[model samples]
Target: MTNSTRIFLFFSFGYFVSYLYRGVNIGFSGFLIEEIGLSAADLGLLTSLYFLGFALTQIPAGAALDTWGPRKVNGVLVLVAAVGSVIFALSDTMWGLMLGRFVIGVGVAVCLGAAFQAMALTFPTHRLPMINGAVVALGGLGGAVVGTPLSLVLDVITWRTASFWLAALTVMVSLCLLFGAHDTAPLHNRKRPTMGDQLRGTWEIARTRAFWQILLFPSIVAGTFYAVQSLWVKPYLLDVNGLPGATVDGLVSLLGFAAVFGSAASGLVARRVERWGISLYHFCGLLLALFVVTEVLILLDVPLPRAFFWISYGFLGGTNALIYAVLVETFPRHTLGRVGTSFNMLVFFLIFLFQNAVGWVVELWEPISVGVYPAQAHIAAWVILLALQTTAGIWYFASKQPKKLEHL
Candidate 1:
């Protein structure tokens, strides 16, 4: 295989594993609650730890990607994830599970940023939108599996057994990434930035107006989307939509399946819209708006086919990932690692907050029955999330357009 193809496959596979780790809690929540006796608040705290660990790694991982390249950084880190999976599988207590999840987050945190940086190094700038989308779509398939496929697996094996199998898969992927992935020729000759220089570069990326302007809407949308998809979507369906367990699994799986297409379409559409003179920023805003409208419908509990809204959510929710392409266009190629991870840090940190916030909001109301929060609690949580997202959207549109974008 071509070196570029090898890089893409290995990094893409790593991202696939990362996404699976992110969404596994959704499918396993029942097992966790039943076995560990977790409440909504406890489950939220446990699940959000993954995002917290992921968020913490971004800046430093960005530097490492810029220095050692993705192959070395990602390969080594993924082993940590494998170890985390083992811990999670063996643990019975909440603290043990949280520790395992946190370690898993730290391990896989490099996957998305490293993939984006590695692709930027290997592929032409113009092709990145589509390539990056394809990567995310593949990762979304992992999300898809964690829904219904994981449910089917749980029918035959314990969650602990499933986790152990997942860990083993993670270790195999790590070896592939370490031994099989190749860096582009330019990356081999690039100068290593000092730790001080990398930190300064990361801070500069964070402070840039273009970064924040491009980030606000998309980050909020991505954060909220993950928060809902990873944990709360099942509860919402159960309590608000009154769907049966089997039906909820199917719909959740459908949402994941739709995301695979949606993220892929976002890239293709972003490229196409640019031909029509629509800026990537505007296209992103449009997707974010569509996502918000879908969330509103869900929050309102509209009478329309429930699958329609969930599908819309899955499709539009992650299209904001295209924002990485936008960042590439604006930033220098050398700093792409920092730029991608800075964006990711905020996005996942917000996911952590949004996930925990939903649980905290729901915790305000008494459960309608054991483990079933009231419909109003779920609705209230959605309202708060939507309000924050809408506020971010308004701020983004009202702000001056980035100078880099004027030419694009």
Candidate 2:
């Protein structure tokens, strides 16, 4: 393979596993609840802990990528994730499982941020939107795999064994990164910034009005989408809609497939819209409005086709990938690593809060049946999430257009 193709595959493999690790919890949710007797609150807290770990690492991981490069930094982090996977597989108690999930989150947190940084370093500026979208589409492949394919694997083996195998696969992917991924030299020809300088640079980005404005939409939409997709949706389908396990798995798989297309399409659409003179902010706002509509439909439990609702959720949800591309394009290349991770930190932290909040909301209403919360409880959680997302959309539209870096 050409070097470009090799680099793409190597980084994409990390992202694939990053997504797989995140979505694997959905496939195991029923099993963990049944076998370990976890409450909805417990499930939400445990899964959110992964985002907690992930959020904590973002700024530091970004700094590391900027200073040490993605190959070494990501390789080491993925190893940590593999170890966490093993711990998770072996754990019988909730605490052990939570700890494992947290570490796994920390390990895989670098996958996307590092890949984006590498792409920024390697590719031309104008091409980043499409390239970034394609990378995210590859990550969606991982999400797709964990849906039906993981469900099939779980039918043949216990969740523990499946997790153990996932751990092994993570190790293999890490090794590939160590051997195959190579970072391009710094583009600006400046000396590498020290850790202190990195922090100061991050702080500069954080202080900008444009940064906060850009952050509004993605943080809310991406955070809510991830919280729902990673934990609640499968249970919601099985409990509220009363779908069979196989059918729910099929729907989730379809959601994953739709997300793959959505991720790929968002960049192309954004570029086309820009060519037509629409701002990225307005385009993103339009997409977020669509996402809110879908959430409202889901909350009302409208008597629509199940596949349409779920697939719409996944497709509209994936469009948030364009937000990352926009951020990359707006920031100075020297600070792109920090800029990407800073935004990611905000997004994941919101996801952590929202995920836990949804669980807490669900737990307020007693389950009507064993392991099944009331449908109204799920609806209540959706209402709160949707409201927050709608508010963010309004905030983005109200804010003045973000100023882009001139050097780009």
Candidate 3:
């Protein structure tokens, strides 16, 4: 294979493992709760800690990517994540589990950002939207693996054992990336910026009003989608619909499959849609409206077939993939790393808050049985999320047009 293809495949593998680590908890949530006696709040905090670690690493990760390149940065961090997986596999207590997950978060935190940076360096700017979509589709494949496949594996092996094997696999992937992936030539011949300069550059990106306007949609929609997909959705199906383990796995897998197609199609179609005269802002607004509708259905507990709810949620969630393309088009290549990570930091921080808050909401209600929270609690959380998304949609429609960056 060509060097570019090799790099793409290596980074894709890293992302696959990153996503698998992110969603694996959903498959094991029931087991963890039952075996460890974790309450809803405990579960939420545990899961959110992963995102917390992820968020905390973003700014530094961005600087590292710009300074050292994705190959080294991703290679080192993913190894750390591998170690976290091993810790998680060995942990029997809540604190140990939390520490493992947090480490995992920090390790895998660079997966997407590094992949995007590598692609941006290697590919033409116009083609990046499609490339990014494909990478995200690979992430969906990872999610799919952790769904039914993980469930099947769990049936045959304990969750801890599965985690152990996953850790070993992660180590292999990280080694491949370290040895096999190639990075683009440096964009500049000037001296590397000092730490203070890197921080100032990040702040410059953060301070832009246009950045905030563009950020609002993804921060709310992507954050909520991730919060549900990564932790709560499967649990909701189990507790509310009372689906069997195999059936829940099947549904979650279907959602992951749909997300794969959705992300790929969105990336492929974005340029064509722009040519057709629809602004990215309006396109995102349209998708957010659809997402809000799906949340409303979940909020009302409308007895529509389970497939419809899960599939729609997964598909609409893919709309957030386009945000990466928008950022790529809006920023200069020199600063793309920081811009990408800044966006990620906000998105994940919101996810951290949303995941924890949802758990708190659920905790307020008494469980009808062990580990089964009331449907009302879920509905309340969904409603709050839905409202926030709707508000963001309206804000997008009413806000001033985002300023164009001539650097692109």
- Model 1 steric clash total: 0
Point out the higher-scoring one by lDDT: 2 or 3.
3
Per residue, candidate 3 scores C-alpha lDDT tens digits across 290-347 of 8888888876778789798878888888767788777776677778888889988999
After superposing candidate 1, which stretches have Cα over 4 Å from the reference?
A: 188-195, 405-408
Highest lDDT: give the candidate number: 1
- Clash counts for the predictions, in order: 0, 0, 0
- The superposed Cα distance between candidate 2 and the true structure at residue 110, in angstroms, equals 1.0
As for candidate 1, its clashing pairs are none
lDDT of 1 by residue, 77-140 (tens): 9999999999999998999999999999999999999888888888999999999998899877
Model 2 residue 262 CA deviation (Å) reads 0.3
lDDT of 2 at 296: 84
Please tell me which model should have the higher lDDT, number 1 or number 3: 1
Q: Which residue pairs in model 2 clash with each other?
A: none
Which candidate number maximizes TM-score?
A: 1
